[model samples]
Target: MSQAVTLWIPGLLDALRVKEAQASLKDLKLPALQTLLAKADKFAVKPQSFYEQASFLFHQPGCLPIAVTKASAELDEFNPNHFWLSVDPVQMIPDRDTLVLVPGKALQITEQESKALLQKFNAHFAEDKVELIWASSQHWYLSIVQPVDIQTTDIEKLAYQSVNAFYPKGNAAQYWRQLLNETQMLFYTHPVNEARREQGWPEINSVWVWGEGKIEADKLLIRTDASIHSNHAYLQGMANLTQSHYCAEPESYQAWLNQIAGFSDPGNGEIDKHFICLDSVADKLDNLQLDEWLTLLQQLEENWFAPLLQALKRDEIDSLLLDLGQEYRAHLKPSHLNRFWRFKKPLNSL
Candidate 1:
C-alpha cells in the first residue's frame, strides 16, 4: 500500500489571508507545497468549519468526538453501549442580546476542580442515571443510562457565539434544556466556583452538552495498516474504539520526521497511514491571536512544509493529503511536481 500522510490545519485559510495582506510569503519558497498544489488531484475550495471537517475524518456516521462511550470503553475495557455526551464546564457571559459561553480551555479549569464538580453532578443526578466523568480540566464526559434522541451543538460551535443560535434542537430538546438549567443552578453556589471566583478565575457557571450520541462502530471509516495519532480526547477515544494506535502529536512534523530514519512502516510495519493533527494554529486563531498565528505559520513552513517537500522529492512518501477542516483539501502526489507551468496562486487564495 502506498503511504499517505494527512495534516489537519485549522485557520489555515485565515493565515493565508495574513500572508497575502503582508505579502509575507512572497519570498517563501515552498517548492513542495507549490508542486503539490499544482498537482492536486482533488481540491475543494469552498469554506467549511474545522469541526465539520475533522468530524468527518474521525467520527462515524451520527457519532461525534465528544461522545466517547465506545472509545472510552475500548481504551479502558469498560462497557461501550451507553449514551455519551460532552458536558463541558463553561463560564457564560450575558451579552446585550444573549449569553455567550466561554471556551473551556480559556476557563483554565483544574483537574481537582473538575473532579469536585463531577462529584456534585453525579450525586445530584444519581437518581436520573446521569454520571459525569472528568477527563481533564477542559475535557469532561457525561454518560447516561438511556439514550436521548436529542441533537446538541458542539461547544466549539458555541464558543464566543450566541448560545441561543446553536441551542439544542430535537425531540428531546426540552429535556436537555431543563437539564442544562438544573446543572447551572447546581454549580451556581458550589464551593468550586466560589474558590475560583475568589482566585479571580472564571467560575464554572454552566455546563454545555454537545457531541451527544451512542457509540456506533459502523460509522468510523478505517484502513488496514493505518495508525491514527492525535491529542484530541475525542479522537483518542475513537482511535481506541477503532483499534488504531493513538499517540500524542509530536511538537512538530520535523520532530517526528527526524525520528523516522527510513520510513519502512510506522513502528509496526503494518501501518502505512500517518495522520498528525496540529491544532495550535486553530487554537490561536480561535482566540484571535493574529501574532501567534503568523508565528506558527512561519514555524510550520520551516519545520513541516519544507521538509515534507524534500521527502516527497526523494520518494520517501507516496502521497500527502491535507485535510484543512475547511472546505478545501490538498491531495498531492510526487508527480505533481512536474507541473511547473501551472499558475501559482498564493496558498491562502486556494
Candidate 2:
C-alpha cells in the first residue's frame, strides 16, 4: 500500500499583490514550489472560502455546519440536540456610507473581554430563548432551543469587505439582523470598548452570526482510518465525529512525518491517506498584510514545499495533491517530478 497526502493551502495563488511589493519575485527562491507547479497536473475546482472548502472536503456540501462542528471541538461537553450558531465578535468600521467588517481574529479580543461582553449579551437575550456561550476570545456560540431559518455568509468571506450585501438572508433574516443591531448597540457602550479605545485597539462593535446548524451523525466523507492534521476547530470536530486519527497542525513536513512514523505500519492498509491544512497565510491574506504574507510564503517554501518534493522523489509518499485555494488543485506523482522540460514559473505567476 502507498501513502498519499493532501495539502490544503488557502491564498496560495492570490499573489497578484505580491508582485507589487518592494521584494522582487526573482529574489524568492522557491525552487521546490515552482517545480511542483511546473510539473504537476492541474484541475479547476469551484471557488470557495477556506471553511467552505473544508466542509466540502468532509462531504457536507451545502451551508457549512460550522457552529455544531466547531462546538464539538471547543466545548467541554457538546450536545448535538441543540441547534448552534457562531456569533463571533467583530469590529465594524464605518467606511463612508459602507460598513467594513474586521474579523475577530484581528481585533485581539481577550478571553476576559469576551466573557464580559457575552455576560451582558446573554442576560439581555435570555428572554429570547437564546444563550451565548464563550468558547474562546475568537469563537462564541449561540445555543437555540428552536431552529431558525436563516442563511449567513462566513466571516472569512466578509472580512475587510462591505457588510451591506452579505447580511444574513432568509425567513429569519429580519430577526437576526435586529438581534445583531441590538448586540452592537449593547457592545458599543461596554467598558471593554471604552478600554480598547483608550489603548488604540479596534472596538468589538458588533457580532457576526454564521455557521448555524446541528451535527448529523455519520455524515463525514473521510475514511475512518484516514489521518487529519489541523489546528482549526471545525476540522478537529470533523475528525472527532468521524473517529479518525487527528493531530495538531505540524510545524513542518518533517515534523508531520516524524509524528506519523509511530503509527501502525502502512502495509497494514489502514492509514494510506492523510489530510493537512496549512492556514498560516489565511489571516495575513485576510488582513491584507502583504509583507507578512511574503515572509510566511518563504517560510513555507523552506519548511514544506521543499521537503515534500524530496519525499515524493524518495517514494516516501506515492502521490501529493495541492489544494491551492481559489478553485485550483494540482496532482503530482514521483514521475511528474522528472519532467525536466517543464520550466519553473515565478511564484508571482501563480
The clash count for each model shown is: 1, 0
Q: Across residues 170-189, which tens digit of lDDT does each residue of candidate 1 receive?
A: 99888778988888899989
Report the Cα lDDT for candidate 2.
0.81
- TM-score of candidate 2 against the unseen true structure: 0.85
Model 2, stretches more than 4 Å misplaced?
21-23, 27-29, 57-63, 93-98, 194-202, 217-219, 265-269, 285-298, 325-327, 338-349
Superposed by TM-score, candidate 1 places the C-alpha of residue 114 at a distance from the truth, in angstroms, of: 2.0
Writing each residue's lDDT as its tens digit, candidate 2 over 1-350 gives: 56789888776655456556536565677888889889999888876666678866655545348898889899997887778899999999999998999999888888899999999998998898678888999899987766889889888789899999888999999999999899889999999999999988889999999988876554545467677888888788878766668888898998988768766765534776788887655545666666666677788889999998898999888989888663468899999988889999866566
Supply candidate 2's per-residue lDDT for 33: 88
How many collisions between residues are there in candidate 2?
Answer: 0
Every model's TM-score:
0.83, 0.85
Alpha-carbon RMSD to native, per candidate: 3.5, 3.4
